[model samples]
Target: MTLEADLRGASAATVRGAIERGDPLPGTAGFAGLVDGALVRDVLGRELVYVDREAAGEGASAGARAEANGSASVWSFDPGGLADPELLPAGSVRPLRGDPAGEDRGEPGGRQVWTLPDPAPETDEGAAVAAVRAAVRESVDEVGSTGLAVAFSGGVDSTAV
Candidate 1:
């Protein structure tokens, strides 16, 4: 199983647990940190979606059933993650549940916003630094030997890696 996200809270751990439990999706906030997110099937034949609850038009869909963000006006249930406006024509409108104020009713849409716990304060700064150095060194060595390629865009994350 593979996950892609700039996760916060217990999201990474939660994903690990979900993989161990053989669950597709572990939690919703596990998806909150994503930007320009979309659902698609990977080469391994696994279906994945990235949904940010606060976003207007993002949700996870497996075939006919889709959970869309309440604010979204136009949505696509594309399995290939390519929702290009010019290439792909408009998809059918699948309305989500809402109140008079247009707030998300949740569920049925499979929208569950998880409140993550506050991160524990860091101690043993030197040890933490050393651990990070060791991990990064290991990663660099492995990537060097394997000839690695990253999805780089000169961002902080890409550069740091």
Candidate 2:
């Protein structure tokens, strides 16, 4: 049975709510119905989109489903360590720490942002520092940058970076 057949008569909100409630629907093996469609399991034993019901019904198809998920994909990863390296290509970048809203700081320019791997280690302070240092070194080496500027907003991560 295909995902569409399983969700053909279901509403997006209903499917999403089932996933949120951890209630797996039929014809879904290690998969869950998201707001869009069924999330199929990937080679890395991760669940990706088997079929994007929203896009298909809307007559849209161009980019991969991964891009459509965006930040929502973060939920696919286990809440402990980094995601499998293969899932995240080499050179993929993301925040070293903290949320994207930059709510941890008050002043606008006071927040610090460091681009690291998408799924960073939960408590690996040493790894975080090393990633930042490597990024700085790479920038200086490749671009011959004479000076560097880091935004410090009194946050522990910002200060460390």
Candidate 3:
């Protein structure tokens, strides 16, 4: 149930064995853009990530890579960021880019580098709800009494927090 504001910190910390994501939330979920120009959507697809329809695609020049690189110009978790955005596939990882420092190709859905692992396997409906509730509650418990005000956007993720 981490807020989008927290993603900056969480994403910054998720490199290999040194993740510092806030808890009682366990492991990870949601959308995160790595410093290495990779875009990741969580296995649950709980958070939506989108790429500009015109900006989506694979095989481009280095210049196009710089322009994409999972930066604000090419990707947004909120669909409103683009006039027409393509919902990034769930549990997927891809680079929003082109070739190195050269010709720019206008394409969509760039080459996928990795598909995030699904750590939470399929479970019974009730069990799934319980698990989700537990994770969210753990996160809420940590954040609720912090005495800092949080802005709620009324989205399912923010509302849960």
Candidates, ranked, TM-score:
3, 1, 2
List TM-scores for all candidates, in order: 0.28, 0.18, 0.42
Query: Which 10 consecutive residues of model 1 have the lowest summed lDDT?
Result: 85-94
Q: Compared with the true structure, what per-residue lDDT tens digits does model 3 show for residues 1-161? A: 22334233245345222322322223555444433454555544566666665655433221222133334345565666555577766545555465232123222344333344448675699998998899988986786556787788988879555
Q: Residue 113 error for model 1, in Å? A: 8.2
Q: Looking at candidate 1, what is the lDDT of residue 138?
A: 90
lDDT of 2 at 143: 62
Model 2 Cα lDDT, one tens digit per residue, 1-161? 22342222345455445434534342223332222322222112224223322333343321223333242222222322212212321111111112332223333212111122256454888978998899988875796436866678887777546
TM-score of decoy 3: 0.42
* Candidate 3: Cα lDDT at 21: 31
- How do the residues 25-110 of candidate 1 rate in per-residue lDDT, one tens digit apiece? 45433222211121222112232333233223453321212234332322233323333221111111112233222233333333
Q: Count the backbone clashes (under 3 Å) in each candidate.
A: 1, 0, 14
Each prediction's whole-model lDDT (CA): 0.34, 0.33, 0.48
TM-score of 2: 0.18
Candidate RMSDs in order: 13.3, 21.1, 10.2
Candidate with best lDDT: 3
Mark the regions of model 2 whose C-alpha exceeds 4 Å error after superposition: 1-118, 145-161
